[model samples]
Target: MEELILTIVKPLVDYPEDVKILVNEDEGRITYQLSVHKEDMGKVIGKQGRVAKSIRTVVYAAAGSTQQKKVFLEIID
Candidate 1:
């Protein structure tokens, strides 16, 4: 899951090497934490958050057929 997230998100940022992702399972939900260079934050989020929304959508879809749980994405500084 972390690899999938990285594969999809790394290209959008300025510092691909600085991109980091962490996943945690608590109860029945999964939370994904994405950390990247400060300069690349806006690019990852995009205007009006559309880019972020798209990313989450892709992650949700990719997680399909595995578990019937919720997925969450967070950008951590």
Candidate 2:
């Protein structure tokens, strides 16, 4: 899951090396906290959060066939 998020986000940022993902699991819920270079935040999020929403949708669909845990995405600055 970490690698999946990285693969999706790295190319969208100016500082690919600064992109990071932290995963947390609690009570059957999985949360992916993504952090990128401050300047690249806008790129990852895109206009009106469409990019972020799209990313989350992709991740959700990818995880659909796996365990039935809830998934959450957080883009942190």
Candidate 3:
């Protein structure tokens, strides 16, 4: 999962090394917190959050097929 996120985001950022993800699981849910360099925030999020929404959609679809737990992806600074 982390790899998928990295693959998707790293190319869009100026500071690939700054990209990070934190995983938290509780109550049958898994949350992935994705953080990127501040300068790349706009690129990852895109206009009106479309890119973020698209990323989340892909992550959710991928997780739905392979995991029983509800999965979420959050983009953060």
What's the TM-score of each model vs. the native?
Answer: 0.91, 0.95, 0.96
Comparing 1 with 2 on lDDT, the higher-scoring candidate is 2
Cα lDDT of model 3 by residue, 1-77, tens digit: 88998999899889999999999999999999999989999999999999999999888989999999999999877
lDDT of 2 by residue, 1-74 (tens): 77788899998899999998888999989999999999999999999999999999988888887858988999
Query: Which portions of model 2 show Cα errors greater than 4 Å?
Result: none
Worst 10 residues of 2 by lDDT: 59-68
lDDT of 1 by residue, 1-77 (tens): 78888998888987999999888989989999999999999999999999989998888888776667788889888
Error of 1 at 56 (Å): 0.2
Please report the candidate that would top lDDT against the real structure. Answer: 3
Q: Name the lDDT of candidate 3.
A: 0.93
| lDDT for each candidate structure | 0.89, 0.91, 0.93
| Candidate 3's TM-score | 0.96
The superposed Cα distance between candidate 1 and the true structure at residue 21, in angstroms, equals: 0.8
Candidate 1: residue 51 lDDT (0-100)? 91
The 10-residue segment with the lowest total lDDT in model 3? 1-10
